[model samples]
Target: MSSPGPRSSVSPSGRSWRDRRLDRDGSLGLRLTLAAVAAFLVLVPFALLAVLVVGSWTPLHELDAAVTAALHRFAADHPGWVRVMKAWTHVFSPGPLRVAALAVVVWVWRRGSRRLALWVVTTMAVGGALGALLKLLVGRDRPELLDPVARAAGFSFPSGHALNATLAAGVLLLVFLPFARGRPGGRLLLWTVAVLLVGVTGLSRVALGVHWASDVLGGWLLGGAVVAATAAAFRTWREQAGLPAGRTTVDGVAPELVDPHA
Candidate 1:
């Protein structure tokens, strides 16, 4: 019998080169599909809102005006509610949220999760910068109320308070979720808190008469998009490093964080 030609290279796991290539291509395709889906879910809404805001769509403008007027009227009648919203907005403002994120970055870095720390910083910075840039580009005015419950300066197409709150909630949730992995109740609580924070922050902006309904909605969409995009990028990095794909929804951005020695 003729001697066999050079044999195909096989990994220790017994996967041939062609099998490995196919696996890699499939993984990459999955990642791309995920990214596309995320973009569609978040960016599409944000872009549509931006277009409507820019074009001064009559129905949207009418809806914003009606919502603002109704909220302002309610604030006028309920001093206690106004005070509570003011307190909530102040506590969750961008400044305090950024400070909290910085503290987490320090904690994670000290724990030897240097990359995770970097991700926290990058996500916050990018979100903040994008918010500011969009504010300038859109140059939309804040809702003007005869008796404003709260006041904010600068352009207001997207509510900064809502954007920052969403970012902070998402970052904190992902960073701490590894610790809650095995506890269903803990996971449920975390999700509830995150949703509550994002929802109330946006509502406070509209109720306080500093932002239109659309503005707050825009902030939420943009903020969520930022978080999803950065998290996806991080996931891609983990895969390229030969790590198992993380169930980000359940385990957070880096389940490796649960390892005391990781």
Candidate 2:
């Protein structure tokens, strides 16, 4: 049998191909929420850095000496554990894993959910770049502790690994939160994983002696701020685009589909 004629598939209003896929709703509350989050995200990192500079400046010089002494003590007692911790921390190095994250984000955005994909990509890109820029501006030094397993040659005020993981995980939480909002079990699982990833990544930097406690804290704050900002921008764009409000399913059967990509 022949396929249905073009008329059968065309929208009766003859809306343009692109127009049919757009949504058209804008909640005042959502716009406000997005704006607040974005503003917070943009400012928090700088504040975090300032705090770190003030609080950790002196302690940083002493940190390496402390770490060296601790390492010597640990080596005499538990050398195997030290090696294991180094390997675990090295696994989180941003070089190769970041490339993988990029690929995953692109693939998910193109094939599955643009909103989720954008969440991942935006958080990582913005947060990682910001962290690097902050490090450059500060131009601090890494601890001269036991030789680093992963060679990150740059100023070490805000830990990049900590920031990257924190942003990525935080955005994932936000994206999933809407759907799981009322479902306590699902929400708990989602948030728990997100927290673990963010927290563990931060701790790993400290465990490896690449960052001071303050740097990790700064990175977390910096990353969270970016996620909030990106989420706000996304919500604003969604509102302005006026796509169908609320969640959309995987299939294109809703009243209208919002192109988050737009």
Candidate 3:
């Protein structure tokens, strides 16, 4: 008797994710459980990254050394280029992030998406606290380059600039994805831009000779974890508000629990 190779896969139970969603019912308990699992899955890589980079890992150390050396070499001939990277680096600096977040908060609040505005601020606040905790735990030092083009203070296990940039980019993506519904091209373009921004921001640290390659990697991973958690939280809020699962536009946002504008 011939057996069926496999049953046809069901459409993602809900929407989004690997283009296929898991079969999760609409229940607060289920959402919380799912959120926790998703957060843990995202955070595991960050934890592993910290362990690998903080320890005496030869391969990571070698790669870090090679990248730092190459960037240092490039800086020697292209001083102007290094200066550009240094300037670009400020886009993700603490001051810019704070300013951007404030603007976003105000914009979203005016648009009647107070929940989203709150999430935006919370993500940054949580990132700063988590970053400090990770740095204290890892206790790693900044890169000692032959010729550093920039100076930094504090432990350098994870690049704060990279982390904050990633969070900000992720927030923008999440906020705008609803606008991109039914337009795969726009979604793809946004994803590409987000990736490039995150990559360049992380690389800026190494290029300017302030952070090791491994530190940037750790920041990316950690930032990814935080983004995942925040996205899940926002999704839950949307679902509870009776918004559409797959497509939700700014015009569709329900009044938040605490409406400052009201």
What TM-score goes with each of the models?
0.88, 0.66, 0.81
The models' CA-based lDDT, in order, is: 0.89, 0.63, 0.76
Model 2 CA lDDT for position 132: 85
Q: What lDDT tens digits, residue by residue, belong to model 2 across residues 89-205?
A: 667666655776777577656655767576677678878888888888777677664554434577887888778777766655554454454577877787788788778777766
Worst 10 residues of 3 by lDDT: 249-258
Judged by lDDT relative to the true structure, which candidate is superior, 1 or 3?
1
Models ranked on TM-score: 1, 3, 2
Worst 10 residues of 1 by lDDT: 16-25
lDDT ranking from best candidate downward: 1, 3, 2
Candidate 1 vs 2: which has more lDDT: 1
Score residue 82 of candidate 3 by CA lDDT: 87
How many pairs of residues in model 3 come into backbone collision? Answer: 1
**Candidate 3 TM-score, true structure as reference:** 0.81
lDDT measured at residue 247 in model 2 versus the true structure, 0 to 100: 36
User: Could you tell which candidate, 1 or 2, scores higher by TM-score?
Assistant: 1
lDDT of 3 by residue, 90-133 (tens): 86686787687789789888887767788888887888779889
